[model samples]
Target chain A: MTAAAPTDRTRLRRAHERGHHDRATIDAILDATPQCAVGYTIDGAPYVTPTLHWREGDHVYWHGSSASRALRACDRAEVCLTVSILDGFVLARSGFHHSVNSRSVMLFGTAFKVTDPAEKEARLTAFIDGLFPGRTGMLRPNTEQEIKSTTILGLEIAETSAKVRSGPPKDDEEDYELPIWAGVIPVAMQAGDPIRDTRNRDGVELPAHLRGWRWPG
Target chain B: MTAAAPTDRTRLRRAHERGHHDRATIDAILDATPQCAVGYTIDGAPYVTPTLHWREGDHVYWHGSSASRALRACDRAEVCLTVSILDGFVLARSGFHHSVNSRSVMLFGTAFKVTDPAEKEARLTAFIDGLFPGRTGMLRPNTEQEIKSTTILGLEIAETSAKVRSGPPKDDEEDYELPIWAGVIPVAMQAGDPIRDTRNRDGVELPAHLRGWRWPG
Candidate 1:
């Protein structure tokens, strides 16, 4: 895949070595995580809301209550969707060099509500199956009113940038000899063991997908 | 001691029950998360950049390279800082009710660079001590050159709102009786064992505070 063209909006001014404008890198970061923070403005005031996001090829989608003000502002304005996964905390011999190991993406685009009933239903089904494979068939299908109450926003991936930081902290040359215990404390955002619903149907097996899906360490 | 006034900007348009404006709740969420996504506009284009954030009282600060375009644009423009912690995944019997148990804060205010030499140094020191406890004395002090290359933006908490979703997913009354396995898969972003730097100074101990500072489970 070709690298995304670096428009004025997507260029990095510092640590340019960590910046990547390639679709491959951006797509990888988006796929690894399901949560994102969306930034949008209303009457000149900016707001960032954390929401669940998923990608299908070059398009990304997120949904919310149809009555959400943040989503409403997002649909009517240019939005920035950012996804970041914190891998670890970097400790350096010098205070100045401390950082974090992370992979993140910033995608700039506009979002619009997914309004078609059939399309929304299919997308919502994809969401369920995306999280728990083959489980959508097990649960009742979305009701017509349920589809109407949800707002799914789709943004074509354009002007995107991905940044990655990994490995040990880079302390100043002289400070490396200092006696501070410097290293990284790995941060794992893991999904713990599932708690079956108190009212769950008796003997329903935990699906394999739910049992296996975990954030990459 | 008083609640933040709910204005047109901070009011929730949906699920008003989940909205909170008290400074105590807002401060609690900010204290727990180390990362935040900042939203700001430059020439009518919106951008969201994730960076490390810390709080001291009602004021919050985040830093980046002084040459960063995003930070430069942020210093002059209005900004929004948002922090979110996903506590668990809510699996409801109905797809429409599926949500995540999370604590999030959206703080809106204009950001200005912490330009004073002594003030910036103190705040940066606070950031280090705040995260690592009594480690600043162990690490090499920052050189003046290092201070010159960093830009820290401070935003006083003026208009902020906190939204929380916890407990089990609130399924429709009828769907709860369905045969679907519905419950929460608890998610935690925790620190793992520290990996010593390959070139660490001999016998430097891992400070006790570093081992103990963890988010409430």
Candidate 2:
């Protein structure tokens, strides 16, 4: 695990309840979800593009079309990447104080575009295998033109902080006397029935791992 | 329903998909989630703050401490407010193309601070009732000091677009010959057992709606 970057911006709120700046906690949250809303600015206007991401050690990687202006603006620029999991709703007696129990990580760093053809291919391969392990070797590798048309950016974990609010809701002391009810309505990600494409060719069987995969707890 | 603000940015990728831009789709996604990550920048530094929000007509409202820099920066400044709901994971043949089926709304508009005391109070009440229907009438109203310490901002839905990807994963046509599995793992939010606060008074029964609240489909 990489040591958390030391900076005032990286410090957790209520340090005691911060659950520590552990790399495992950060990695778990990143791996639990497949998508993130990448927030960046172009000409002082804020724009957010949701894209699939994967983590390798302390760095996160995402790819977009080479022609994407948002991706072009993000290359080598300071970016704020966030991934959040809505665990449950925290209902409280006081309406103003109601909150949600969630786990999220905000990473602030400058993204370095992968321009090396070999490195880009390897990173893109690792990204795919990260989400669907053991499948990289079976598919045809990206052609040179394909590699040139995709822009991959890697953001180092600098000045990153995780803010998690968990457990039950905390209502105001005075509002405890009110007759309203308060508790969590938990949210979860569950696997549904799989639908195979009609264009699937003959003699293909779904892998056991994919057929029985469950969301990490 | 108010007509969607006309702009090249608000246009849908497929014209047929433009019909989903009506008020019903926007309101349904907004009302489903109470929290949103409001993205803005101060002096070119990007910041994303999570806050509770409510929608009325073609506008969205969010409040924070009067001293909040993000809120103050948003006043009269162009802002990008996004709401995303992750429905399932897209398991594609290539990891680079792995994605999630999600619904997200991005709106670009100038925000105006709500300083009128009476209108601020009304917005606060609407925020509460929007999440927990009928509860605002049962609780005591906000005090003058509480109202004064908070600033509410409204962003008109000037230029808005909704992007949604659902159903099974879309793998490359040629990759279908590979033996790898490809399908979606559905995700959902489920209710949990309620935990009564230790300080609760006697004879307070949970409301009927609270007992069986469900996430909209």
Candidate 3:
């Protein structure tokens, strides 16, 4: 899938070498984690709210309570949505060169509210079933009131750039001779055993979607 | 240590019950992970940049290349810094109730550039040693040019709030009786074995800091 080219807003100013404009790189980083922070302006002041996000085709979506002021402010307004994953710690011989290995994608665009009730419901269902496929069909259908109380927002994949840093620290040639231990301490997100709710009905065994679930690090 | 009260911006408008104003709650969420996204405006457009951050006393600090335009825009400007950790996935009987367990803190304040060279150096050292403890002392000291080429910015924790959601899914009473599975799949950040720099001189064993280092989450 072709991605939008880097715009002035998405261009990397500092470490331009780490910037990637391809859709493959951007989508991988976006799909690796459901965690994302959406930054938008409310009354000309910047507010960043961390929320769960998912991607469908070329658009990324996030949702909140319909009454959310943050969501209201984002509708038809410019927004910056970022998805990041900490890869590892890059320990170097000097403090200036010390850094963390990470993968991140920063998308710049206008966020519009998913106004159509049917589209909103379908997108919300995709969000849930995206993580645990087939589970959404098994659950009780969402009521009209439930759908009305939620708001989903989406942004196209234009004006986006992905920055990634990995491998050992890059230190000054002279500093490499120092005795300091320099390398990478790899970090990743992992899932522990599932904890069943006490109210769960008997004979409802763990489903296949979650039994084989693994965090995409 | 006491924290600042939630201002008009820091207060949780959606889930007021999940809001926490105490310093312990805010600091733990800040310290658990170094990953942070700094949101600030450039010519009325919001930009969120992911970077490593460390807290000292009641202030949070992050640094970047001296030539960074993002850092320049943030200096002494209204900015929002957020740190978040994804805890688990809350699967419920209905799509509306599906959620993720997470801890996040959003801090709003003006970020000031650390101009004092000595203080900047000390804070940079603290950023490194904050994770590995004593390893900063073992590394070659940062040179004057290195210090001159970095920009360190800090923001006081005067208006901040921590939002946390954990445990099993909270579904409607009638939905809970459905056969769909409901539970929480706990998630955490884990560190793998350290990889030594290929350029290391012979006999430089893994230091105690890296050997015992573990992600706080």
Candidate 4:
């Protein structure tokens, strides 16, 4: 794992001291979650579109409809893309001090639409392969016309920050005397039993990697 | 449940038919998730801030630091607030068609700051209690000094819409015959064992509600 690059953009809040800035920390949070809320503005009105995103090094990639207004505005324009995962509920003695454990990343940069045909295909393949791993090899590739109709946007990790809050909540000393339940409820995302497509031909065995997929903690 | 108010802004997506417009659907999705990525523009740059949010009837409220630049710009400005829950992973025969079962609500409205002290306190209490039912009554109320240091912003549900994708993935009829694995992996957030605060005073019984608190599905 690469050490987090020191920059003002990556500062964590005092309450978010558990938040990690290292490359591995950022990648872990991003990889565990597949969707991101892409935020951009059009004519001064803010818009957030939830889309599937895959990470490649410091860059994040997402595709939208050819006619998406938000995508058009994001092309070469500054955008904010955020991914957040709720880890658990934090029950605290004090109401004002209650909080949740979460991992979130906010990247501030300009997005450039990927236009090269071959590059687009590779990135799209990378996107699918990142989520499904070896399964990408078994699928048909994208056609030129299909690739032409999709718009892929990439945002370089220039000024990025990750804020995380973990462990149990801290309560005021006086509030601790109050009878209240307090603890952290751990949340997780796990893979379930594979469902074979009804129309799948006679006997293709499930890939080894996909059969028992488990995300590293 | 109130019928979805018909408006151009609240209309469901044409391409996605399962998206719902009922108020119960919107509120349930919003209430189940406690955090939202608030998108706004400051000095022509886009910023997305993750903050805890709560819904009251058709209005949604969120708060941030009194000194937050993003909060200041968003107050009184048209903003987009989005809350999303990733329910499951959707595996399809085609890579391009792979998706996730998700519930998302997008609100387009102007946000206004709560200036009245009494109203602000009430709203803040409601926000906290909404996340942890019955916890507010057990804790100390916010003082004038504390209230003055927080900024609360509210967005009405005048122009809002929700989109949901559930059940199995929709693969192309032709691709269904491909030799592949396909199905949904259900994801959820659950509670864990409570950790007693080290500073807690002796003999304080845990509140009954907190001990068995479970998020409504």
Candidate 5:
């Protein structure tokens, strides 16, 4: 896979060693996490909203109520969508060297509203099935009213950068010798057993796809 | 625990039912998660960056290399700090009703640079000890140069709001009778075994505070 060169805005000014411009690294981080924080401007001040995100090919998409002011502001606006996964906590001997093991991707683009009815519906279904494959086919189709009330926003995955820090702490050369317990407490998002909704139909069973799905998959 | 009235910027324009203005809910969400995305504008374009965050009293703090351009842009600038935790995937009978159980807090304020030398040092120490209590005294003290090379940014926790969604999927009344599997797959950040740094001295052991520290504590 070809790696895209970082634009001036996406370039890492510090800790350039942790910066990754390759699509493989960037796509992996994007695919690993379903939640993302979207940054968009209204008038002039910035607002960050946490929203579920999904990727399809080179475009990333998020949806919300059509009445959402933040979503309306994000339409056609230059937005920054960031997905971050906390991998671990890095403990070091010195306060300055304390860090986190994380993988994050930041994409800069104009968030174009998915106006085509067919495209919006397809993307929304892709999002659902993307997380729970084949589950969409079993679920009731989206009603026309439901589709109308939702606003789907999409951004091309261009001008992107991924930053990752893994393994252990990198303390100053001398601090490594201190009599301190310096290491990492690996952290990951784990999915518990599937919970059946109280209102489920009598014979419904937890589907096979969901049983096989795992967090950070 | 007084609930602050939502400001224009912090108000939840949609789904006000899930909106929380009380300090208890806001603080709980903020404290429950250490990773946050800070949204700030540069040249009127929004930029969101993930960073580790900690709270003290009525303020929140995050620090990074003094040479970071994003940190420099955040200083004295109006910024939005957001923390989000994905609790579960809310699978519903319809794609439109699908949602994620999440707890998120968004705080908006001017990101003030910590200029006081003593305050900076104390806050940095509090951050380390905040996550891992008593670990500061156990480790090598921060050198003067380390302090000089770190830029700490803080924001008062006044203008804040939290949005949380839990429980099973909230599908339409009629849709509940559908044969689809509707439920929540609980998700949480779980910590694995602590991996000690290879360079640790012979007698170093995983400290009590760390072993007892749980993720999402």
Candidate 6:
């Protein structure tokens, strides 16, 4: 497991035990979640926008409208990408110890635009195929105009960390004697039955990917 | 509906139609979700952290460990708080129209620490009772020490906006004839059966609040 070097920005000041700097742990987190929050600053104020993210090897990519102020600012500034999966809520006897069990990743790097058209197309196809193994061939190819209107940014896995907490709550020794129910109430992002579009083409079958979609198993 | 004044910071450069400046819309979105992402800057770099959030009247509050570097920096800096609910995935015939059906709220303001002990305690209790209805009475009250170890930051909804999109995908007139399955796959965050702690006291029954907890309904 190759680990990212601890820079001043990536160091964990609190809960250092739960922090991991290895790429193996970071990749596990990025692969499990499709959504992420991007942090960037404009005129010294910070903004976080939620969007879809995908990974390939040691790179992470996300796209937004070409006119997005956050995206345009981030392309030229330092940014942070964070992805989180809330596993469960930990109920403890003491309010101090009550917390959530989760897996999360934080990465800091400069985001640069993917200017090459060929590279952009490959990444776009990977975004679809990664979620649906063989659905790329079934859809119409993206037009040149459509590609021009979108902005894609890529960041290397240069400085990153993963924090994971699982299992029951850790209450103080004295608090355990209280007659209070304490345990974990597991939470999940569950996919429900698909709602076919009212305008779906006739005789179109439900693709295997959309029928059984899930994240962070 | 009270609307937030549009400063350059709160303006929507892209997807202008989806942006809403009304307080009625912003509060409704904030009241429905339990979590939010906070964006703050340190040494000119931006970081986004995910944590639980609660709203009271015109103010929003989030708590963190007193030792957290992000919270310490945010108490003095300008911050952005964003909440998002991923309702469904929009699958269109052409990739350009593909999007997600979601309701999100973003607020830009300065966060200040709640230094008064009494106000902090009351807000803490409100956080629990807000979700569990009547469950606060069943648990032991918090001690002074537990309160001191936590840091609570409050931000007013002075400059805010709510963005929402729902319904089926909007396919192009020419691409509607393509033989591709297109529609929304409804997504939700759901609670499963609560797992009793291995150290739960004997004879403790699963509380009604825990048994039927739902979000942003």
C-alpha lDDT values of all predictions: 0.84, 0.73, 0.89, 0.76, 0.89, 0.84
Residue B66 lDDT in model 1? Answer: 92
In candidate 4, list every pair of residues with a backbone clash: A185-B192
Residue range B1-217, candidate 3, lDDT tens digits: 7867678888777788888989999998999999899999998999898888999999999999989998998998999999989899998888888888999999999999999889998998888888998888888888889899999999998899999998889999987788787999999999999999998877899998888779975
Best by DockQ: 5
Q: List the candidate 5 regions with Cα displacement exceeding 4 Å.
A: none
Per-residue lDDT of candidate 1, residues B67-172 (tens digit): 8888998996799889999888888787777788999988888898899878888999899888888778887888888899999999998888899888877777
Ranking by DockQ: 5, 3, 6, 1, 4, 2
Q: In candidate 4 chain A, where is summed lDDT lowest over 10 consecutive residues?
A: A6-15
lDDT of 3: 0.89
Backbone clashes in model 5, listed as residue pairs: none
- Which pairs of residues have clashing backbones in candidate 3? none
lDDT of 5 by residue, A1-217 (tens): 4788778998887788999999889889999988899999988998999898999999999999999898999999899999999899998887777788999999999999998888888998888888888888887877888888899999998899999999889888977777889999998988989899989999998898899569854
Which stretches of model 4 miss by more than 4 angstroms? A1-24, A177-179, A195-206, A215-217, B1-16
Instruction: Identify the superior model by DockQ, candidate 4 or candidate 6.
Output: 6
Model 6: residue B140 alpha-carbon error in angstroms: 2.6
The CA lDDT at A127 in model 3 is 85
Worst 10 residues of 5 chain A by lDDT: A208-217
- Model 2 fnat value: 0.43
Q: Write the per-residue lDDT of candidate 3 for residues A1-217, one digit (tens) a residue.
A: 7867678888877778899989999999999999898999987888888888999999999998989988898899999999989989988888878888999999999998898999988998788878888888888888899899999999999889999998899999987788777899999999999999889999999999899689965
Looking at model 2, residue A70 earns an lDDT score of: 68
Instruction: Tell me the TM-score of each prediction against the true structure.
Output: 0.95, 0.87, 0.98, 0.89, 0.97, 0.97
Model 2 residue runs over 4 Å out of place are A2-8, A11-24, A138-140, B2-24, B94-97, B169-180
Tens digits of per-residue lDDT, candidate 2, B64-119, equal 77876668888998788888777777767765556677777777788899989999
> How large is the C-alpha RMSD of every model relative to the true structure?
1.8, 3.2, 1.2, 2.9, 1.2, 1.4
What is the lDDT for A152 in model 2?
A: 92
**What does candidate 5's lDDT look like per residue over B82-117, in tens digits?**
999889998888888888899999999999999888
Q: Estimate, for each residue in B79-127, the C-alpha lDDT of model 4 and write its tens digit.
A: 8899887777777776667777888988888999999989988998888
